[model samples]
Target chain A: MVTPLEIIRKKRAEAVNRIVSKGYLSTIRVYVGMATCEIAAGSKEVMEVFRQAIANGLTDVYLSQKGCAGRCNLEPTVEVIEEGKIPVKYGRVTPEKAREIVERHLKKGEVITEWAI
Target chain B: MEDVQYKMMLCDGVSCIHNQSKELQSAIESELDKSGIRDAVSIHLSGCLGMCNKGPILIVNPGYTIYGGVGSEDVPEIVQSHLVEGKPVARLVIEEDHLYNRFFRIFGDVDFFGKQMRITLRNCGVIDPENIDDYLSVRGYEALAKVLCDMTPEQVVAEVKKSGLRGRGGAGFPTGLKWGFTAAQKADEKYVICNADEGDPGAFMDRSAIEGDPHTVIEGIIIGGYAVGATKGIVYIRAEYPLAIKRLEKAIEDAREHGFLGKDILGTDFSFDVEIRLGAGAFVCGEETALIHSIEGARGMPRPRPPYPSVSGLFGKPTLINNVETWANIPVIILDGGEWLSSIGTETSKGTKVFALAGKVHNTGLVEVPMGTTLREIVYDIGGGIPNGKKFKAVQTGGPSGGCLPEEYLDTQIDYESLAKAGSIMGSGGMIVIDEESCMVSLARFFIEFTQDESCGKCTPCREGTKRMLEILTRIVEGKGKAGDIEKLERLGSMIKKSSLCGLGQSAPNPVLSTIKNFREEYEEHIEQKKCRAGQCVALLSYVVNDECVGCGACKRICPTGAIEGTRKEKHLILDEKCIRCGQCYDVCKFEAINKV
Candidate 1:
């Protein structure tokens, strides 16, 4: 339904505006060690939990992923970084823990001290 | 303040963490409170010191003494001896451990640090990945400073050429050669690009590098920019990798703030900066040409290229693109100089390669081995051999685009040329170990299915040929294969490899080709007798209870459908009609009771 001229204009706008305007830069980062060791350690659910949480507006966070930390046994591991603090690496974060992390850490920044990293 | 000297750096690395590490932490805190020496010492939980076996560990700083297997009971002794008397605890101390001695007594010899070269894994377990200071403290930006201050663009290219380093992003193309090609162009604006779109199955070396140590890649790209006369760098990472992207973004910001990335970098006349572009998870977008198009906001499909990215790329600017691992090596090569870097690995490869060693391998994680290291050493010695004591079959090195090498080639030194010589490519170093019980046809189908799902579908040969090949392999695995199916698969595979425009299409047939070549008997049994030798292909399988079965009703209860039929306290039989072949019953039988024929 779009014309070639409109598409070209859209492309031009994309190029020029990306430089001029800073986009929604709030980093909603999530980490899942999907390496073989992490997979064996069950990181897939950790990712799913993040996905579901993000879908639910639990926290406006970046859902990111990483490979193994070379420490493969801590499967379903996650690391969260916000405004001020060292990034917290939370290991074996299950769906339940993930939910709690979203509610406690992501929303309030009161780091769920026990599950924070 | 009483004293802030009772420091404890606990090892919360995966190995220790699993062994009730949190409990150990609580115990230390509680014990410290009881002794009233908590104020004298502090606790900092660090990462894996790499001796993963005996952990739940702690290393007290200042003296940098190490302790292993210290449970809740040992904290009191630790505080009294180290915090109070400032003397080493003899019972809990790790004296014989070479790593501890060097770490505490002397300064060097990073334990578990013998005989291994780290280029890709340079920052792992050493520097806190999230901290730019940790990276800076370890001489991170010195290469950037040297490249800008000392070396000319031509000289940088020459040094890389002399080092003989090649791309670790699968194809093993000579890095210097690619740089020189991009450098040869006299464009007004040039770009340094990093391909972080790692989509290979069971491959995660790139992800680890980016996540664990992202600054290395950024520094490498900045140096690459200096070499190629590029003012801009773009890291084309997959959108699927939120961690790599996040780390990369942080690194870019950090570099800019530190005068390592933005204009007049480190007070030099040179000006360079980087931006990030995200890929929508197409495997083909990993190709340099396709990556260029994607960065330009075009369709992420590759076009025929004589004007390669070196000649025309990213809105037709001259570009130099290297994978994350390739970029990681540049900083090391630059700082050490070419000859020192060239000392390791085979003559052709000239460095270490990081692999995501998975499947039947015991230590299934990231391993970095020098190029030309035999598959035998990587799979057996370093990887702790195969699990369950199964006979080794073949390793699918690279990804779908790489060939499978059999046990006969275990001694073959790992390098681009050597792997290719053995009919397999050294690909992106996804070394997936296969055991005796794996069916070759099913394996091929698995990879083909993966590629097919990921195909961008821009080219005819790739789109159609991959689909056809996948269908054939699927048929063979499901026991619906005909006599000439193998021949058809070969023909289609060869055509796809030859005619496909990009690397993805070209190497798409490698799985089918290599499996057929190495495990021909496996394929033959599947085709000729309509039986799967490995019992992996579900359609060619039927579940039956053998003498090993005891009724117990566990299998019956677990079955989603009423697939199992049996009397109480007796052996259960698999009912063919009612059995949905879900294999739920097979999983529940305690003994090796259920047999699939």
Candidate 2:
């Protein structure tokens, strides 16, 4: 019989594997800077923009909120990471740009150079 | 159609809530519904991002764009423009320097976080604190598992001791040694208490730690319990921190469900459980003895030490008490080993310290730096210097119990020994940067007043001494002080420091004493010349109409007291007797006519 300790060890292993595998499986990832400062600076609207885009059938893209990267003045930051590609960080993202990023960048596989910080 | 392609994590920290982040969340939900994409995206709540000033933060995945300062009014535009049209809003994007590129480079090379080394705050702001899975994925509870499975109790204590970890709760006591003392005690029941009663004015390090990553603190506490052979743990936190309390409560519940906190954890016989005890917001209760008293359902008053809490404490049993920050350091020590931590900080003090950077600094937020990092680096490089181009006057450290250091002391490395040698205790890390506009004499008086009011009055020296010092400082600020008032204050301050029963009274006069030592001339000017150069003391200020005044009659018209008497387009003259010294005329003077002397 497996003891409680062994059960927990197994659970931990399973969690690590699940998280690591998820990171690898996703073809493209979108990260929003969702720190308190970023929220105060209007990142929520940006998130909604992305949500709507995804609902419009944006596929193969996994989106999540990450913690503050400490660049507070340029908050509401956004970054797009594609597998085997350099991640692109976009600062001061608004709702309108969120749609453009989804259509122009995520769909066409192009970085929004003018807006990327 | 397919799985949700976008996930947005919204900050649920107290600061964000205060900024109406919940309203923002609902607004986003409604907007998503309007755009008909509610099913394609998901929104999850996360912890603090450390940028409290800019709250209600949101991050979107797959092209990580962090939008800050979001409001409800801006929601529809975001959905219509970005989500529907496939174009991001240009006006709302937070434009930052292109120096930083990584999304989760919390320890990145940016100016605000460049100098910071986040060890105690490792997972803070990064993980969804309420979710145990997020914490577990980041190597949480693994240290506890390692301690319970591989290392014996003695070995655990030895590793902590070897790490050279000291208490982060003001006093730099060895944490491992304290555990050793408790382990040696002969008792059927032993207790370990996490002292979360962080009472320092402007200090929120403990609150943020618990709010951002409660599991880390919980994990540290459990490891501590295993090391000291304690089966019971209590978190004595202040009731003022409702969000922190709620998060900690949830974290405890989650940890228990996951079998990390309950009996026979990880299939070992070392069963440990933790309970939460709320403090009624007493500053003195931060003292270990007083904290234990409060936890025992008694009045929160500190008793004299001899039989320290490690020997006999909490209902006549050996108890181990560590501060919130101290306990938060445990898992890192266990996971990284003592030698690894020992290599980071100064020669004596190992690892990093978290400071609540407030006051005149441009970036007034939480910053953690390795021990021995200079005050200049903290105040300038990391804090972005004093705001509005104001001259850096001084930085106050250690809160009310700590002292204010002058610009000359900027090079002094921040460590236990150096801070104490500078006549300031390394308090629970409340660093307030002072600008040139603030008068040191008034600042000293403000701190002394707080201590005098909070003085438990249990001891005579702290009670009577702080009251008298405050009175003298008050008199000095009001321009009623005599020649010998400063000296009298010094004598009383030192006496109180020596005779106080607890840490409160002993360190109560620290602000006054340190200000006197560094800015003695400010006090001398206040007493002798009856002049406050910073013009902070209203009673000592006298407004005069100077030649620079252009008879604009703006000052005369705007002066509530009608103290200024002048014609249009001419220099104004202030009636000194009628002037209440409100500085209204000075502010209204367009031609720089009003002079404050």
Candidate 3:
């Protein structure tokens, strides 16, 4: 006999739990722009390169795809997020640059200042 | 176990998806896993964030720091510096100051979103739209619960009336008054209809609202049902908006499961249910009478309306129809009180109005601002002015039915009365900024064509008058203007406005009349001088070789009709008789050789 109040409370608690488990508060997230403009700008190849690199070695990261980043001219946009840090956005990335980022930045923990948007 | 410390929101709206936001998401996840910080962060894929031009946008919580134009390769650096180390990557950060100052010459001292007061769009891009729990967490459905438990039907109506909310579906009918009318009607069977048939071109406020927070609309509709003593609500959304429909369907299902909708809503005696009916993409179906007719399994046509929808609607019973944006505003008005809302906007028009700022502007997207916010602020400040430094010419507000306003009227405050005073109605929030490049005559012709095509043809004035007006406007744009064409158009336009049965017919001639009134010079240039200053009227333009031509022979080689005849490194001659006006040579010319005169 769950009341409506209890159901709402339960839903709220579940939302909090979902948020935590999905890495809203604790996980580093990488968002790749996969909109038509970005696809036209060779984002598909860049995304493929990132996926292959992740499968080869990357860990503790949550990688996902998203829609366009408004700057059409600067397509193939990506944003990275981690707890207690400022999110970094990079634009106009190629497949080779994506691999180099995975090796130097993700693995060795160095910010690639030149590639950052 | 360590507690989560940060939240990251990635915009996954229509435009953002086009920019490869999906790849960016996976790359971030991979980086976080590598850094072993997966347990300390949360990521949300959200809807449009208004600044769609700067997608795929990422917002980090705690500071609301936004990063735009990000790519997969940059994900590693973000993980390294920001995820592992405590410092934010400076270069990638989208500075608030920069967004405000980028077009300082145009906007002067005002910020992009300085005048914007987001009420209906408060939860957009802030929550995951698909997740019901996320919506519930943000005090969603609390208004419905409050309405059901604490207030009576008359009381709810009074509060709404006090809020001074008007219909957002083009005509600014008082929402509270409309509800009161339906409530006063003694009908056993009553219905609440949400007019989600957004048929206006380039307007997407309602679609974005539904996609961003579906639960809000659901809550608002349910509350309206309660207020009007109605047992059933129907969302009349167009089939064209597949994403909004999907999200709304999910939201409705979730609400029913959670006891917010269906029988005995939120532990109260008030029982109401909502269902969706898809419109077959007819622009005329947006009108109340036509919509009611369509809902009744008849042809989508407008009938005479003295016994309005409130008296005799939806199967000969009283029906209350409100726009999607109007319904979306209900929950907030109920929760925050009408006095709070009424205080925000102008004296006449209260609360925020959502405008789809589009066409030839820098920041082309959705913006929700208070009623009194000037067009100057909307175009220059929020929209970042005309793109590529083009001179501002005119702005068309209120869709095809609305009028075009010239540059001098930019300072006019936006409200129902103010817009009406400027010869344009505060339509369903489609504001298209026209630059110097767009010919006013061609623009008027384009809108008249749309209205003419969309007219339901049931009434003689709308169907026949619009057709006649379209013919005259078309001929003018095609360089076949007559002496009395403008006067004939004005006569036909006023006749349509007076004699038309429905709103579609009455407002059909607005684009033509308004453009002629505002940009008469452009129209005269086309008619008298036999030229289009904007070069948009193809019939009025002639291709010629200019003095700037370096005689590269590129135009001669590229001309499909072989109109250009010249020796190598010599001035080209265009045989006007043989020219097809394809403009292929114009595009291929390297030395600015080709000109359209």
lDDT comparison, 1 vs 2, better candidate = 2
For candidate 2, write residues B363-412 as lDDT tens digits.
77788887877899888877878878789999999999999998899999
Chain B vs. true chain B: TM-score per candidate: 0.81, 0.81, 0.82
TM-score per model over all chains? 0.72, 0.79, 0.79
lDDT of each: 0.75, 0.79, 0.79
**Model 2 reaches what TM-score against the true structure?**
0.79
> What's candidate 3's DockQ score?
0.13
User: Which digits, one per residue and each the tens of the lDDT, describe model 3 over residues B1-597?
Assistant: 123456667766556789898999999998899889998876766444445567788866545667888889888887787757756778889854321112111111113333455678766644557777667767777677667657889999999999999999979999999999999999899999999999889787787778767788888888888888889999999998776788789889988998888888767667889999999999999999899888988999988888989998999999999998999889888877787677667789988899988898987766877787789988887787888989999889999999999988999999999999998989999999999899988888888899899998888998999999989988998899988888898999999999999999999999999988988888888889898999888888889998888788888888888888988777889999888888888898877868899
Candidate 3 local Cα displacement, residue B540, angstroms: 1.1
Q: Residue B577 deviation, candidate 3, in Å?
A: 2.4
Between candidates 2 and 3, the DockQ winner: 3
